[model samples]
Target: MKEELLFVRHLHVEFQHGGQKEEAVRDVSFDVGCGEIVGVVGESGSGKSTVMCAVLDVLPQDADVSYEQLWIRGGKSSAAMVFQDPSAYLNPTIKVGRQLIETILLHPEPVTEKATQQQKKNSRKRAWEHAEKLLEMTGIRNPEEIMKRYPFELSGGQQQRIVLAIALACRPSLLIADEPTTALDVTVQRQILDRLKRIAEETHTSVLLVSHDLGVVAALAKRILVMKDGEIIETGTAEEIFHEAKEQYTRELVEAARKHGSRSQDKRRISETILFQAEHLSFQYTKFHFLKKKSTEAVQDVSFFLRKGESYGLVGESGSGKTTLARMMTGIIEPSAGQILYLKERWKSLQKGRSKAQCQKIQMVFQNCAQALDPKRTIGEALTEPLEIRGGGMQDVWKTEAAETLFKVGLESEILEKYPGELSGGQRQRIGIARALMLKPELLVLDEPVSALDVTVQEQILQLLERLQREQELTYFFISHDLNVVRRICDRIGVLYNGRLVESGDAEQLYREPWHPYTKELMLSTLTADPKKMRRRRNVPELTSRGGTGSGEENGCPYADRCGYVMECCKKERPELYRFEDREVACFLYSEQHSGKRSKEYRMASQI
Candidate 1:
């Protein structure tokens, strides 16, 4: 039999809150073998993260924890944990390098017979070098430069890599990572998962990966443990857990993941009449300097249209101009070159047409509900602001409407009295969505609105959005990095690389047959729910090469550098948009093709 690295026998955790004893984690047991990857899958409040926290002895003082038997491979047990939110786990004020060094120094060891100053200097240098190496192992480019920066200086994906690096710095026998890649884009998530797999192989480290994303668990875990309301409901190998799930909750989760595979076929057809259009949209940010004035083009010549009551998806990696485009579309930022046409009326400019009524017409729901809602304001106040700004006739009417909207989003009316701090992350997000719905807008710009939510809550929110769209005829400009969520809700999909749209078609069509190399890469990087499928898909060739040499370009194919099917002409000139039946692909491969009988054949072959 293989040796086990860590063992948990009948662990139970409770908490005393407001004089009531609440069971947060029930009887749970699992084992992590040497060099094994164990996954704990659950939704919010399922106690997956709580169990890990209890094991690390980091639970709050008010909590009660007990276990029948907890043991480690070695007599001396040392463990490290990486949190879901990198920003919360890290000290925002400190530099990345300083925090890493401090964490490393926590494990006590006698210093060599040298001066105290020399030891301190050597420790810092050693910490820096170790941090650099770990970052490199995690596939981060320019590790030295990243080490010098603070948490806020890096993107969410970059910050996550830093957190993982810090956790691995201790070289603990057991590592606990809670939804480590939940915040990353698909491509970055794949790279991070690959790094974790490699680390487990090389260091023989035991990994306890906690996540609600089944795809992530399917890709990494050998043994699967399903938790619900703090109890371990099912435990088995990944294949058995996925294919032969016994518990109802486990089966529900498996079905949700499998459902995503079929959602591509259910995409709704887009209407011909464009409700919102952006023609040659270009935007730049001013770079203030004492010497020369310069501008960086955040979005360049981006054009797309949304039909009334349709959901249009915008997908790309972080810093790929996804959020910037959302801001431009919603009039949060004015474009320098293009015009936004709404209801067949062209706005002189976003800045010029900005008004309270216009703003009410296009509401936005941001990613972080905690930050988006005013900390001082109660939920009622937050939901009422829009109606107040619109100057409604009856206060009671507005209150009734707000209450109904809250109920529609799966929240109780009493929640309106509580402040944002009192609500959980999922509850706060629901409130945010409710606030947006209260405006009764024609369009809603949801920027990663459900990205921070758990899988179960995400399902509810998606259903709510779909319901509202059907009943109220609400149009959505959905921006997200999760391809699964986009596939579930979007009518049409647009692939953005850098600042340009390389592919546009029905969501089903694009997922079925992605012509753009960047789009194909994004799709390929997504982890599936089935372990067998995940392994099979990983072996499939990636669309691009190193440095992204063949991706299409601004003038030509932006994916030229990374594309596997790059041609000499692709390097010299950019490919124009080629119409192939109902889809449009920007690639040199179809340059010779015309929008006729041959195009239909190409579309059929591409399976779009």
Candidate 2:
């Protein structure tokens, strides 16, 4: 039998909101075995995070908590936590090295006493070295250089890695990770999970992971606890919870997660006519350093065409310029080095001036639905405001159109009266879609539209988009990091790496057997609900830096540093997208010159 690292019994927590008592957790009982990785999963507001907070005794003062027994064998300092957003916990003004060293100084492994100035100096040097080693363990390259950089200088994945390093600085016996990889890309998420698993095994630390993603939970946790409506609805091994759950809620959650991003079997035959095209589109941001100017390319020489009523998806990590490309397509920004053709009409810059018809034809839906909406304005106003701005419709006519649009998006007329803050996340997202549809757009640029939504709600939104596209003949330029979501919705998909289109092809084909190293890494890193299929992922090496940009040299292949089958030529020159079977991959391995020298890695990837 395994030893108990953490014990809790009858854990209950309540919060006083507007003088009303609201229960967040009720009668929760679970224990973490020594060195075991456990997971607790549920939808938002289902009490998973609340229970974790209660156990850590980090709830707000307004929260009232009661429990029969709650204990951590190694005491308070023996455990640490990593939150969803690392920026919230990190000090933006301080350097990474100073911050990490400060954490080490605070939580001394031997519980040392105060010392003289000379002793402090010696301890400081040792702490700095230890901090560098910790950062190295988290798969960060040039830990010394990263130590000098501020938190804002790092990408989302890099920031999360630093946060994890700090959490491990205390040498904690128990580590609580709450949504640590929720907002990361598939490759980065896999790296983080791999690091956690390795650490747990090496140090015999217990992990309490909480997330809404069943795939993520299944990937890391050996034992799983399903939470719903402030209760532990089910508990079992990862396989049992995923495949043989007794509770209807657990089964529903699993089904919803599996259904959200599954590839669609129905291949809709759309028109061959092109609706929009980007010809070598590139955008550069120029910054002035004293008197000298430095230019950074955000999007570089990317060319793709979208057919009428067809969805084209772009997948990339956080800084791979997906959003920038979307903004250019929607006319929010202009290309610095290329042309944009809409309906075969070449445009220089939309910001300079564009026809009202042009503006009305291409509408965009952002990821954050709540922020896309006006909080002070009623939903009715938001919907009609678009028509009102156009100045061609009467008030009554606008209201009627708004009502019909709501119905089309599966909402009711009653929702028009409520403000954005009053509605749920799913409802707000639906409202965002309705607002975009009010303009009767021909093309919709959806930027991570369903990323922030729950699994079931995401499926609903995806279905609604499909239905609307078929009915209205709307063309979509969808951008997201979720490969599965992209596969489900997009007819063709493009993979971006460091501002370049590394691969593009049929969505299902790429997902089935990606040719590009980056694309293959993305497909392999994506966590699935099936535990058996996910087990091998834990052993995959850290192929790229969690920061999205790997340690490749300038003017060469962006992924050469991380590609397992990289050739000497890859670092000397950049490879353009070459035709490979039915897809375009920017790798010499698929090119005629290197085709005869295909590595075992390429063969293995092809077989997958």
Candidate 3:
């Protein structure tokens, strides 16, 4: 039999919150073998992450935890954890490379062979070497350059990879990855899973991956444990759990996954009236030093139009200019170049320069409602801020308007009285939507609106957006990395890469028949809920995604370096947006300049 790495039986955890004892985890039991990948799958607050924390012994001091038979081949020191939110875990002031190397020195593994005092003194050099190796192992291409940049300078996906490198620096025997790929894009997500599998196999490390993503859990885990309301409901092999789940909750999760397989069939009736038009839209930011300032384009000569009643998706990995583009559209910032035409008028980009009517025409629902809403203010005050600050109509009507908005967002009138801190994640998000609706805007720019939400909550918000769009005749510039969410709501989709548009077309057609190599990779990276579709034998070759957020500054195809069918011509100059069937793709295979084989590989990549 395979060597048993960890065996935990009857684990329990209770936390103190608001003078109340609440059970966070209850009677959870599971085991992992040497070089095993065991997944704990559940929705948010199901205690999937809490149970893993119990095993790792990283819970807060005030919490209560108990275990009947907790045995690890190696103790707590042998395990390292990667958190869900990279931003929250990493130091904002420190550079990523330095932090990674520091972690290695801080947690040095025991030397098997006895070394001299002089050899021990050379650990700094050895630590740097290990840090570089870990960085490369986690799919960072330009490690030397990336290492110099601070954590805030990097994108969410880049920070996540750096965090992973730091976790693996100690070379722990057991790695507990909790929602490791939650902030990552599809390509980076694939690379992370591949790298983890390799490390587990080559180094004999065991992994306990906890995630709310069923597709991700199915892709990696050999054995599966299902959790609900802090209790382990079912345990089985990947195939068994996905295909033959016995419990009702387990079946519901499996069904959610299976339902996620097909394309979203919702169709919208978009009008010909161009509600929002972005012409030659470009934006750039300057990096400051004492004397020298360098300008880098966050968004470049890109343009798209959103109809009066359409939900348009802006899809890309982190730092692909999705947020920057959304902010520009909402007049949060002025573009250095190009113009925004709203309702056939030249709309001002600067917020202060724009009229109150222009402001009322466009409103945004921010990504993190917790940060967006004022903590001290009640939800009613939060909703009224838009009307109060703008001096819309009269002060007496503000409360009435807030009430109507709350109901419009599908919340009870009582919700307006509570502060944002008192509400749940989903409820806070609804309040955010209500606040946006209070402005009664014709266009809404939603930046990763449903990303931070749980899957069930995400679906509910999507449905709410759908109903609101139809009822209010609202247009949306929906920015998100989740292709499934985009597919469900977006009438059209544009693939953004390195501050530019790579492809633009109908959502369904682009997903089904992608022309650009990067688009193909993004689709390939999207994980579905089926376990049988994933690699089980574990001999799959390591396919590294070189650039997570962008292609390098070389005057060639940004993705050419990582493209499987890269040709010599692809290295010379960047490809322009070429016309493909009802879409624009920045690739040469379809153009007259193309010569080599492309279909078989492209077709295989398109198989959802």
Candidate 4:
């Protein structure tokens, strides 16, 4: 039998809010065994994080927490935590190397005051060595260079790895990860999860993983705890929880995770006319330090077209320029090079300078609906503000239209009276959609619209978007890091890496057989709740991803360092988007210049 590392029983927590005591977590109980991983999963506000906080004694002073029995083998100090956002926890001013080394020196044991200078020096040296080793263990290469950079200098994946390294620095018996990959792209999320699994096996650390993503939980956890309304509804093995849950909530969660709406078999025919096009679009951000200017291309020469009533997905990881491309399409930011054609007409003006008619033709639903919708304004005002700005509509008419639009988005007319703060995440998202629809725009640029919502809520929003698209013949330029979500809604998908468009083709076909190395990695990185599929994936070898030292500076293929099929030519010259039947992939393996055995096999596969 496995040894139990941490145990809690009958845990209850409450906080004082608005003159009332609100129960955040109630009657929660669970245990983590040595070298075991346990997952707690539920929607937002279900108190998953609260239970972990209570265990760590990190709740606010106004809160009350208690348990019938609570114990860990090595006490709370022997535990370390990794949160969702690494940036929030890490110091911006300090180098990550120092931060990690500092954590190592402070934990387990600190140097005694009576120790000699040489002893202290030796201890510090050991800590630095351990820090680099931890960084390497988390899949970070060239740890010494990474140590010299601050948190802000690293990519999101790198930053998260640094945080994970810091947490492991103490050699803690227990590691609590709270929605650690919630904001990460699928590939990076896989890397982080892989690192966690490896560390747990190698160090015998117990992990308490908390997340709303059922797929993520299913991917890593041996045992799963289903939480809802501040209580654990069920506890079982991952296979049992995902496939044979007795609780309705657990079943519903599994169903939602599995149910990405398929493209309608009788989908309406998309118009042949191009609604928007970006020709060799490029954007550069110029930064100055000490009176010296340095320019970084956020987007490189790229081209893509969206047809009327079609959904085009731009898929990539964080910092892959998805948002930058979206901004260019929406006129939020003008491209530094190339032309934007809307309805075959050149669009040279920024959003502010665009005519009212142009504004009415394109609308955007921002990623953070909370920030997009003003806290001070009612939902009705938010919906009507666009019309008021565009003019030619009375206030009463605007309000009436707002109500109708709200109903279209599956929201009640009564929602208009509520403030953005009073509404839930799903409600805010619907409100954002309703506001975008007030203009009855021909195109909608959705930037990670459902990335932050629960899986169930994400399904609802995707369905709503599909319904709206079909009903209104609205064209969608959707951008996201989730390839699974994109496959569900997008007709055609483009894969981006380091500011370049590497592949573009039918969404289903791309998903079925991705030609680009990066695209294939993305598909493999996608975690699902299906037990059979996960078992097969577990047998696959870990592939190198496009993150880490020497990966960002490649002048040829951005993925050259990570590509399993990379040839010597890949490091010398960049490949353009070469045509292959109906698909286009930017890799030498599919190009005429390639003559190797692997290239021949890839070419034959492409034709098939």
lDDT (Cα atoms) of all candidates against the true structure: 0.81, 0.87, 0.82, 0.86
Worst 10 residues of 1 by lDDT: 539-548
Instruction: State the local distance difference test value for candidate 3.
Output: 0.82
Q: Candidate 2: misplaced stretches above 4 Å?
A: 111-114, 266-269, 543-553, 580-582, 596-608
For every candidate, C-alpha RMSD to the true structure in Å = 3.6, 3.2, 4.0, 2.9
TM-score of each: 0.90, 0.94, 0.91, 0.94
Off by over 4 Å in 4: 110-113, 261-266, 351-353, 538-555, 595-604
Residue pairs with clashing backbones, model 2: none
Off by over 4 Å in 3: 94-98, 106-117, 142-149, 258-261, 394-396, 536-554, 592-608
Q: By descending lDDT, how would the candidates be arranged? A: 2, 4, 3, 1
lDDT of 1 by residue, 235-339 (tens): 999999999988988988888776655563433444667788889898888987888799877777888888987999999877778888888877778888988
Score candidate 1 by lDDT: 0.81
lDDT of 2 by residue, 1-608 (tens): 98999999999999999999999889999999999999998888889888888888889999999999999997867889999999999999999999999999998656357677888888899999999999988888789999999999998889999999999998999999999997788888988998998888998989999898888898989999988889998899999998999999888888878875577665566898989999999999899999999988999999999999899999999988999998888788889988889889986556778777788989999899898888999999999998988888689999999999999999999998999999988899999889999999999999899887777778889989988988899999999999988998899999998899999999887888788878888888888887878986545566545323243556668787778887788877788888645578788876657666566455323522
Clashing pairs in 3: none
lDDT of 4 at 315: 93
List model 3 lDDT by residue over 312-337, tens digit each. Answer: 99999887799998888878899899
